[model samples]
Target chain A: MLLIDDLHASIGDSEILHGVSLEVPDGEIHAVMGPNGSGKSTLAHVLAGRDPYEVTGGRVIYDGVDLLAMAPEERAAAGVFLAFQQPVEIPGVPTMYFLRTALNAQRRARGEEELGPVEFLALVDTKRRLVDMERALLDRAVNDGFSGGERKRNEILQMLILEPRLAVLDETDSGLDIDALRVVADGVTTLRGPDRSALLITHHQRLLEHLVPDRVHVLAGGRIVRSGGPDLAVELEAHGYATLDSPAVEPRTASAGTASIGTISTGTISTGTISTGTISTGTISTGTISTGTAR
Target chain B: MTAMTRPATARRPPSGTGVGMGVQVPERAREPEWLNAARRQAVAWVDANGFPSTKHEDWRYTKLDSVLALPLAASSGRGAEDGPGSVSSSDLPTPQLGVPRIVVVNGGMVPELSTLGTSLPGGVRVESMAGAVRRPEGRFQQLWTRRLGGYPHALRALNDAEALDAVVIDLPARTVVEDPIEVVFVSMPTGDARWSHPRLIVVAGARASATLVETYLSVAGAPSVTNALTQVELGTEAELVHYVLQGERTDSFHFSSLEGHLAEGSRLSSRLLATGGRIGRHEVDVVLAGEGSQVDLDGLFLTGAGQHHDNPVLVEHAAPGCTSRQLYKGVVTSDGHGVFNGHLVVRPGADGTDAVQVNKNLLLSERAEVDTRPRLEINADDVACSHGAAVGRLDPEALFYLRSRGVPEREARAVLVSGFAHEILERFGSGPIRRHAEELAAAAGLIVLDEDHCSSGAVTAGTVHPGRGGRAQ
Candidate 1:
């Protein structure tokens, strides 16, 4: 449902994402793992159409439509949702009021009839149980004085209410406790369907245990260096990203097969053997490419 | 005191016949000895101090040039065709919260037009000032003689000098009046320029409690000047809630002085709202005279294009254990200008005094302007006193958040502005008073939505109708 081709973006004088290419097909979940300053959050913001991040090159196609040409609200109306890393606290505006306005605005933009108060409240109540959000929180000013866990749950609640076609989760597990992570992961798992797509951006593989993805891509130096099955996450966890810096290792194509194993020298600058072999489970492709070190 | 003189540009009209001169006073022989002497003294004081110049500290931000240039005449007994004579109780701004109302047309109290019952509670007196002054031994005479000139103000002296009548409310000791006393002053100018000076005196005896709502409204596009003075005295342990609403014509001017004196353990809450007039000024001076007294002062002013409003409040903590609070908010749009000056003083002997003052303003347009000065003069060592003042526009992030949710930009701004004013309006302590304030604010194009609209499933936002002016409909 989403296709990003050589997307080059920058903020001010520094270019964050350079020639990054990836795709999340319909009905599949993809995870992007990168270290600090890997442009993980920057990619999410650019997708949500936030300002000041100039898209200098390439394009994004969502369901065959030009995604970069739409305004933020227009993107939201067109079923593009980005769960922010930190939800903004809007004082004097109640949460329920904001939700109803947003729901109606999106529905109106899509030529759908607006829901009445009773109908909107009924829908909200149904979604509130899915995310375990308190009714009192809905009555307060949007995220005003809310705890870290409550803000994440509120974001999930909004996602459930809007029921967008594509969802982008940026560091959704950054501040969650063990129980909150399970609940949030369950919320994302429940949103899985044949037509829905999701891109999970995180620095840790712990969240992957709760909500497993079909594809795991290691993003480093503003590019996706490797793509493999879910086992790639387990491998990255066992050995840290230091192994990915070996000169012998190269970029891998996702069709290379399931478990594209490589052997490397056990020294500071490891030299590993890259292989691209097709297995019955999946395909893995590896080739020699410039290994950009993580900053 | 030295004799005050006018500037070189000040024109001296015919001294014996003009409005501010000595001709407006009543015949000396027809009045009581004390009344005649008081009026003569006031008139002499006003002549000595022509009019307050901008150089005076109190009138620094407000200019009276346009107000002084108009030729002022006393209102005739016959009410103008478009005055209060044509207005029904249902047509009032806050008809939803009805109370026993007294109507004053031009400057004189109209008994036929008033809605006061034939009899009031025992030990409570509500009568016209003219009637009270005529009585041989009335309580109004005693209260007036003791309270009329308690303070020295040039415009207040002018009001007392040429005042024709007033509304005098007296509550005896230990009395608790249930309903609020509503006094509506309607100004309707004649063909030529005219001005009205309406005076009111309220005295709450020891342990007495009451609520007073004073409303000043003028007909559409009336060219008139309303110079009003109100003096309040609260005895030991008395409680009083005073609310004043000023809604006049955009082409007219309004000047009012509210002076309050609180005695031992007395509690006073004063609220003032100004939403009309080409230029309006409400000066309030409050003194906590006895130990353990408390006072609360709140005001809100909304000004649009070509309008100017000023509020200068002075609160004095004189006795130990006295407390005072002042919060004033203003929203200026277009070319409108607003001013707020709050001065709080804790005397040397008032060691246990507690005072807080805050003034916040929102400027909606590039041309809009606000001048806010919150001054604190703390002389007592054992006192807690703080003052704050802020002037800015709405938070850009908050605005963007609202707009991102599909609320139109104008409606979002209106919501923020309403919320800013709601902080002070909620302090009214009752739903009816707050609702009344919301109605008045809505009439001024401030976009106040009903509570049901928010709690219910309705997603409709409040709309702004600046063309409606101050009319209820």
Candidate 2:
């Protein structure tokens, strides 16, 4: 459902994603594992149409539409969702209010009737149980004073409510506990269908256990070095992205769209494989990327 | 005292008569002697200190050049339209709260327009100041006798001297008013700069509880100046919810002062929403006079294009175990100006005092400016006091978050702005008053709220649905 062709993005003068080539086909969940500063979150943000990152080259085609040409809201209306790694705390915007506005905006954009208060509330109540979100939290300002686990769950709740066609999870599993991870995984699984697609960006393979992906692509030096079945995650979990030195050597079987682009753009491929330990523990400064890093 | 001369740019008198020099004090044979003397003394004070210049410490950020240039010496009481005659009642911005309301036209209470009438509840007295002073043996004498913080402000003294009538709400001991009493001051100017000194005197007896709403509105873009003053006394253990909504014409000047005295264990919540007036200035001085008293002061000044609003609040902690919280927010756009000055004073021997003051402003444009000062004067050794002020544009991440959720940029900004004002609006307390304040915010273009949100008693997120801002193609 989503095709990214040699997407090169830069933050200011520093180019983070040199040539990211990946694809999440319809009805499949693809996990993107990378070391620190591999532009994993940069890909997610660029997909979501976040500002600050200049897409220097390449195009993103979602369901035959030019996704990069659309505004953030337009992308959302077109069924593209990005679950932020760190949800922004909006002090005054109520969580439920924002959700309903978003849901209605998307529905309206699709030429569907807007849901009234009663209908919206009913939908929210049904979705609330899916993520075990407290009703009190809905009344609060968006993500303000919410714990890390609750924020992750809140993101899942939004995902369930919006029910987008393509979902991009950017390091959502970083700060969540096991239970929250399970809930998030269940939410993603429930959203799985023939028409839906998801791209899970993570630094570890622990989340792969809950929501096993159809494909696992090791993203290193801002390029997908290897693509294999779900076993690729297990292999990386045992060894890590440090073992993957060569780039684009694996058979381009991730998707039909990626198979055409056999040779990924050759940029400065650093052999300095920043360990996942350094990626997860310390702050990784990737130019203006909203990954697992503090904004 | 030195006899100060009028400045080169003082206000021009309305006519060649001494009456228009200030608020014309009405003379009746049966009026109390003390009131007449107080009025005379106030007039003399104004004559000596004819409106402080910008050099004055208190008037530093506010310039009265435009206000002084107008012919505002004539009071609204005389030669004005009779009893809402000129302006139709439909033109008034009345909040449909379904409570007992008193309508004052140009500083004079019109009995025909007021709804209190004989339905006024027992143990409660809602009358004009003209009527209260004639009672001879009421609490109005004592409450009006005491000075407010011993600081005689220039505009306040002018209001005292020139004022003709006011709304006096007297709640007896232990009386709990179920509904709020709303006083709407409708200003319909007669083709000139008319000054209306509207006063409100509220005295809640011991253990009594009541809610009061004072609304100031102008009609037909009138050129007028509304000099308003409110004196409140909350008796021991009494509670009072005071809300002031100022939505005058952009060509009008609104100057309001509120003096609150809280007794032992009393609680006072003062919320002000200023959305109108070319230059709106409000001075709030609240004194925690007795032990265990608490006060919550919240204000939101939403201005746009050629408008300036200033709120200077002073909270005096005179007794021990008193708590005072001040939260003031402003939204300035398109060259609009907003100012907030919060002064907190903890008196000596007033230990165990907890005070917090926060002032936040949102400047939407580069020219939109806000001058905020949160000053703290701590005299007591053991007191928990903190003051902070922040002025910035809307959060970009928050805007992106909203937009990324399919909300358009304009609607997303409206949501964030509404949310920013929601903190202060929620402090208006639940029920119709809060709804009215929300409606006022929406009307001022400070926030965008839908119909469902307006009718809801408690403003919930469930009710907020932004307008369909150009459905994403």
| RMSD vs true structure, all candidates | 10.3, 7.7
Looking at model 2, the pairs that clash are B23-B162
Backbone collision count in every prediction? 9, 1
True contacts kept of each: 0.11, 0.68
lDDT of 1 at B394: 79
Q: State the weakest 10-residue window (summed lDDT) of model 2 chain A.
A: A254-263
lDDT of 2: 0.78
lDDT string for model 1 (A130-216, tens) is 888888888887789999999999888888888888889888889799888887788788888999989999888998999999999
lDDT of 2 by residue, B1-473 (tens): 01111112225453322233454444435557887777767766655556766677677778877876677554454212344445555765555455578777667776655678455568798888767876768667676657622335567877776566778889998998878888888766654546777888998899999888889988764578898889999999999988999988888889999999999999999889999899999899999999999999889998878999989898999999999999999888777888887899999999999999999888777677788878999999889999889887778899899889998777787778888988888777777777778777877775543323322212222222222111100
